[model samples]
Target: MQTPFKLSLSAQDIACERGGRTLFRNLDFAVEPGQALLVSGPNGAGKTSLLRQLAGLLPLAGGRLVTDGADADTPIAELSHYVGHLNAAKTAFTVRENLAFWADFLAEGQGDPADHLAGALAAFGLGELGRLPAGLLSAGQKRKLALSRLFAAPRPLWLLDEPSVSLDVASVKKLDGAMRDHLKAGGIAVVSTHVPLETKFTHTLDLGLERAA
Candidate 1:
């Protein structure tokens, strides 16, 4: 069994800029285990930028982002599963191959390979298309496959940007279930989306209105 670990994340006095234009500044929020932060805003409001910064993909223009109750030395990128707007799948690879690669690449010494792969495929309703080439999948199917990576690896933090994009109502519900399960397992998530995710343990951060004023 995996050892239990406490997880917490916070951003203090955060600021971000793109092309010399400030998107948001002085943003602050905190999320503990079993909790989620829902980031909502209009286009160009820096919702994606915030998630990228938290994922350690983009540099923080200003402020401190902290992760507590875990190994202090481990970077946020290593502890997080960042699902961006684009589906990070290899078009040439089969669905199973793409998922298998992620399962091993992001394993971080946790979860059984076979079990996690199977569970992820099933979770996204992609079991039957496992052998099909990813390039052939519909947009929704590719999104599902991309999201399945969260199930294939156990990460304490999830950084999602418009995760429900290209998904149907049923698939959206499945994504919600995945997020719910992640939170229940003591994982923290920061999601940037326009779609409302019906969950009881979510906190909202409206970058558009907050930053405009």
Candidate 2:
């Protein structure tokens, strides 16, 4: 059997700010392998900011973030995949090309790119659209292409901001299934979303409550 991936991520007394405004403070949460962290809050509650801090894209206003297991000394960006609200894809590239580029760029010595490429496309219902340019895809399809990167290169931590946005019901189910499989394989996911996602193990952190305190 393949050895399971181990991951431990925690935030303590964390704080974030944006646009000269304090979004949240003293936020804390721990995510373990085989589990998910669901971040929920009202608009401008710092949900996305918190995820960015964890992903190392934004500097924390206060407190420290800790990570254990699997290249602990490596920067969070190297060990995690951060998918923000925007679909980060090359509009000029075809679906296959986009996935292929990510698979190569983020290999991390994991599974074969060919396998990941095929699996990601199939997982997100994009197998038939692989040759189509990303810019031509519908909104939902663009979202799927963005999400396929998670599978294209297996990362231990996933920081997703509003991952379910623009997804159809069927696509949402697919996303849930992918998360379930990732957790089952000992991967960790931190998702900020208004849409409820069904997973086997989940922990929720409400940023609105953190902001109110």
Candidate 3:
């Protein structure tokens, strides 16, 4: 909480293992505010594993992770939003209801205009379908719904995994803008993408070459 280093990520000899196989080890890196870390690698390179570790989902094999700056003093309960492949789409509720549920669950305040699902719906090309049941949406549409949840979140850290998957070209561009705005808003994003990014990376961390086992 002392702002030891702005936007800090310090992992000393960090390692991870899955299914008895060591995924990666002795990995150490740090990124600061106004910087984005692009995580890329071939499939099965432990990209997701590293992101999960940063999000505090998976335990680090040998080291620790510390995020400061805007996230200083923020509890893991409040520091970040971890979004992956899970479909939070409600088979029974409309898209609006799904986001509403998220806002309440994340303890976000009500009557917040920025939490508008409509704007996100339009940005993602799902405007007309906000009233429709999420279960009725196509796979791609479902992914868009997942993205809309971010707007209603107050966390400063974003852990996104392969967010570009299943998105069309235009949707990917819109997604890019959303991510950029998040960074511009002083948020930190750690994303793992197999697909290309729309903008230059502040830094690229390759997990494939860093595997320790």
Candidate 4:
């Protein structure tokens, strides 16, 4: 029985190496209440790895990470919701059930569970499809289902990776609006995308130019 060494909650000077290839290094960023950060980079630029560090899913080779809002950093797992490219839900569960699962998981006296569910369903135009199993939904509908988690769970920060993929124009608008509302509510978000976001935020970090050695 051994208690392994665990990394910090958040990281500065984050770097990663895969397959003996250096991705990038000396990265510094933080998430704050009411602030949103967009991580823009070319494919294979370590955007996901950077997020992994923040999410505490990967061990940092070197750096200091924190969650106390000290030096403007916080534990990503505690401060934000990380939405990766994969969606793992009981596809057989109805759309409402899917949301309800998350709503229930993250609902610990923050907001009323029912209110969050209603807001998510109505806000995303899924009121009629609430009972439909997620597997039966269209691609765009599934994407919407995926996006609904943001509203159901209240976190101070958000780590979204390529949220615009497979989304139609209307759904995209809805997604953008939801994100805008999230930012307006004093929540911080870090998003990675190749598509030009319609968001009006002036603060963004472009990792696309980071040269790999």
Pairwise TM-score winner, candidates 1 and 2: 1
**How well is each residue in 1-213 modelled by candidate 2, as lDDT tens digits?**
123779888888898988889998888888888888888899988888888888888999999988888675788778788999888899999999999998877874876778878877888989999999999999999999999988777788988999889999999998988887888888899988887777654788988887787
User: Residue 113 in candidate 3 has what lDDT?
Assistant: 44
Write candidate 1's Cα lDDT for 88-193 as tens digits.
9999999999998888888857857877788778888999999999999999999999899887777889889889999999999988888777788888888987
Candidate with the greatest TM-score versus the true structure: 1
Task: Indicate whether candidate 1 or candidate 3 has the larger TM-score.
Answer: 1
Point out where model 3 deviates above 4 Å.
Answer: 1-7, 70-73, 109-125
Better of 1 and 4 by lDDT: 1
What's the lDDT of the predicted structure labeled candidate 3? 0.72
Cα-lDDT of candidate 1:
0.87
Instruction: Report how far off residue 23 is in candidate 1 (Å).
Output: 0.7
- Candidate 3 per-residue lDDT, tens place, 116-212, comes to 5545455566667868999898888899888877765555667789888898898889889877777776666778887888855688888877863
lDDT of each: 0.87, 0.86, 0.72, 0.72
| lDDT (Cα, 0-100) at 68 in candidate 3 | 59
Model 1 weakest lDDT span, ten residues long: 1-10
Clashing pairs in 1: none
| Residue-level lDDT tens digits of model 4 in 1-213 | 111112223347867777777777776766555566778778888888777766778777677666654235434565567777876556889999999888888766666888888877876799899988999888778877877887776776677888888888888788788777777776667788878778765467666565542
Clashes of 2: 0
